[model samples]
Target: MDEQVITGTTAAEIAASVRALHERGALRRGDALPPVRELAAQLQVNRNTAVAAYRLLAQAGVVVARGRAGTVIAGVEAVAQEGYAADSVLRDVGTGNPDPGRIPDLSSALARATGRPVLYGEPVIDPALEARALAWVRDDLPDPELRITVTNGAVDAVERLLAQALLRDDAVALEDPCFLASIHTVRHGGYRAVPVPVDAEGMTVDGLRAALDAGVRAIICTPRAQNPTGATLSPARAAALRALLADHPYVLVIEDDHFSMLSQRPYETLIGPGHRRFALVRSVSKFLGPDMCLAIAATDPETADRLAFRLSPGTTWVSHILQRLVLAQLTDGTVLREVADAGRHYASQNAAFAARLTERGLPAEAGDGLNLWVALPVEARIVAERLMRRGWLARTGDEFLLGAHPAPSHHLRLTVHDLTAEEAARLVDDLVEAAGRSAPRS
Candidate 1:
């Protein structure tokens, strides 16, 4: 590709030209581009204009900066996502999904959710939903001066919050063994992910301090029922984090309480009362169902105002119908009871599974979320491979790790809440057999 393939004066124009070249197959993936100064001089534009153009491309994932090696067209990498893989014949114990049998039926809520046509210029959140959401999150959040915003889901809210608060390439603190969607979101946005190590008691104090020292602009945390590991923040841990964050009040803190209604553990927050920027997001997915696609974010007024731009009226606003549906289910007595039962059910089932695994000589713990984080004596990949041979598809813990040299994860996240007794027993036996096969021999 010729250097002249990239041509334009302004930032947008330069970005457009590069995009056009890529579209025409003239600038293929991994192809090096001229240095910023060289490109600026050739195009007769300011060096800053060239820099801005590259920034835009990087943010859009069209190109990536390679330090002294200069910029190159980005090769898209396939990211792993949640839910079951299509057309798989194996019994999928790895899918981090809530039991459909436990999810409250939405048929009755649908009737109540409809009625009242919402026109343009109306409020984005349904009035009833907003009121209920405020009450729902009021006691849990530290800050009293909160404004509510509804987004498609917890992931959408995090993406918007980061976009509003930080620039591309800015550092954001995420749990080391992070959620799949979060890792994908941060990578797709071209942001730097600073890994904050999570333990049995949730995000560690030292890890968080290191992230803050690394100049992270934002921190995404799971207050309870953390994904993969299922580590909930203890009160002591939350207090220690609050103390550490006291000096850096302006750093945006986003607590994703995705398992709010169904969490067996009480909510613990890292956001202190005086914290300048924070958002507490609660999605109804766990108890209500994933297809609902509604999450309520109770955020500081300023953060909420900034988030409004991304969720502009009539453009990206979450549907009022969905909001009403969630609100209807949230307030219904029978539905609330069912959600509570679901929480207890998940806890008991996970505990039972953990006990079975422990009895078989593989130590396992019943974590707060929908899954059990079971540690294996051998490498998780080896055990997973062995399990595959035995007609089971399992998720290895390495898939959730961050950074270039992450510690080898020897664990597997298993969702066994919905499994029948016979299936559960067979799975335990198979897992133990797989681990035994994978263990190193003398």
Candidate 2:
């Protein structure tokens, strides 16, 4: 260890070393650093010098001290980079957000919804929004007889729904590498996440059956554009899921149709007629403006009643003002027009990028959602690491997988919905390079 000497002669040298560590972004808030003794030994510095450096760093507001948590990174998210490229690409291929330009425009009509000042404690449910949102999810949910509830967002709705339905340690089945929010929700609530396998055809019914057999109390399945995968559940596959859930009457099936309005593919009904307990959660966040954090959930009357109770107790309900805003846009002819435009923009961007990939000999294709899933011949982790070097971040299929044995398929979930033509082309080229680099180095 003495052979690897890191001498710090002057105060500037110690300051430079500390600054270098801070610049790397690894040493962030709430993250503990090596003990002064350990670091001094590593850097071959005097213990007093190490203490001085720590003190200097602390004074800079770069980190804070907690008894056990130690020094952590502060003011990180606010720090801006040179171009949006490394940070969020001022042009494209970053932020992983749906194209705001293409979101259903509410500009002309939203003003009318704000006509009246919204009164708190009044029935927060916007009947107009409910009527409109119901139509949006009509194809995938129960008959007109079923009840619907409005929520702040699909995320908020899912959290409330899971809370209402499951107790701690209760088993819930989710697609392997499911949506990040769902995964976090399950963990936050201390619920055991049961993994269900998803292939090109979406979630496998057989895997779901196995999870249920293992005594999962609830199942949350994404029918189409299965988040990172962009694999739509085929009608046949949906039917299989229905039969599996039908056999387990007590298991609550929560189908997340977050991509509803934006997805071009025909919707698949995983919660079949015979399936009694189910909730179809749909959010406008992806297709519509995120500022309008609204979701329309259609479920059986009993489940709706329970969810209402969860949303109730106090006046914690969906805002009528926000709902009215959404309803105004929805009822007007504007949304359908925006939906068409958004769909075209998304399909075109994804298709162009996929075509670029295919040209570079990486087989890729456009899927229904705001993203596309590309499968490489090699492992995705290897490919993703190489991509990280080129300032590209991607959600891997592993994040969505729900199985035990490591059937590692090399796939990347890429969001091209906001990518410009040139950016898309460059991304495809970079991806092909990364894919090549990931090849086994035997």
Candidate 3:
């Protein structure tokens, strides 16, 4: 076999070769590629071409740039959330999806959205939706110069928001156990992910200050319902973070309020009165359903203008139909009631499960989100395997880790909102048994 794994001249050709290598098992995750200069000399191509090739690979999440460590195959690839294994006989509690039964019908809203055809050069954001979104966003954000722009969803909004503000190789502060989409977006855009640990109150003050000191140009935070952990920013924590960020006003701070109206916790923000370069994104997916595919991004006027350039006429404006549909659901009393009910349902179900886990002597914390973050008394992977044997599939916390070669985590993020009372009780028992079985005897 040839030791020369990468072989191509052009950037596209080189990227394709790397992808081929990855697919064939020739390139495993975390395997470092040859240095840019070395690979260029080997391929007889210019150094710039090799650099471009690596850049493309990084952008596709096939590779990652580790600063002084050079590039390596991505430990966590950017793809859709992993769901149940097809043909598996286990009940899947790993999928982070809202209950289909609870998602409100949008037939009436869709019917009303059929009025007009949006043409090129028309306003990218619908006027009525903008007005409503502006009022809604303003009620929460303390910054008065905020502007609203709608995107496909929370992920798209964050991607564009980061792109508008930072360049490739720039450091972006991310929660340690972050949302998968945010993780993927950062990795795919070829940006460095600075781990900011999150406590129960939200992002830790020391973590934020350290990231800032490390020269992070941007910070992506989840104000509420932080995925995987279900942590929300407490008012005191938010105030402290806001105070710290006031000194570094130019660092682009993005707060993804993906849970938004669905969260039981009150909305707290880190963007202070005069803080510049910030974005507050709220997606309709949690309440309206993932298929709704629309999110409102409220950002500073300058960031909004840069985002607008990317969303210009022939570029990537979110569909007007989806925007109108979200607006209709937001304005409709019956739909709003259904959404509110769904939110309560999620909270109640998670709380009940957390209580059961605690009663069983396993500490579990249920925060404001669709999933329950349960700490295991043993390794999460072993407990997950035990659950699989008992016909319950679960998501281990290791999958959400940011740093390289992190210590094994003992938490599992379970989506138990759709489970019945009997089912929930059965799951709790199984989880308790599984944890006990996986625990090493003292």
Assess each prediction's global lDDT (C-alpha) against the native.
0.90, 0.72, 0.87
> Best candidate per lDDT, number?
1
Task: Write down the RMSD of candidate 2 (Cα, Å).
Answer: 12.2
Q: What's the lDDT for residue 13 in model 3?
A: 97
The better-scoring model by TM-score among 1 and 2 is 1
128: Cα error in model 2, Å: 1.7
TM-score of 3: 0.85
Q: What tens digits encode model 3's per-residue C-alpha lDDT throughout 146-202?
A: 799988888899998888887777799999888888888987787889999988999
Task: Please write out the lDDT profile of model 1 over residues 1-442, one tens digit for every residue.
Answer: 7898787889999999999999899999899999999999999999999999999998777898878889999876667889997899999998999999999998999899887788888888788888898999888874668899999999999999999998777899999899999999988887889999899999999999999999999999998889889999999999999999999999999999999988889889999988999999988888899998889899999999998889988799998888888888988999999999999999999999898888777778898999988898888999999999999999999989896554577899888998999899889888988888332211
TM-score of each predicted structure versus truth: 0.91, 0.75, 0.85
After superposition, candidate 3 runs with Cα above 4 Å error: 1-87, 404-406, 437-442
**lDDT per residue as tens, model 2, 1-442:** 1212323644457656555665775444455566667767877778888777666665555544444655444443321111124444333332346777777667676677785656655555776777776777776674766778888898788888888887655789988767767787776665668888787788897888889888998888888877667778888887777777777876788889887777778888777776667888888787776677998889888889888887762567876667777777767676777877787778777888787677678878877777688889788888877777777776556665544555775888777767666666667767888888332211
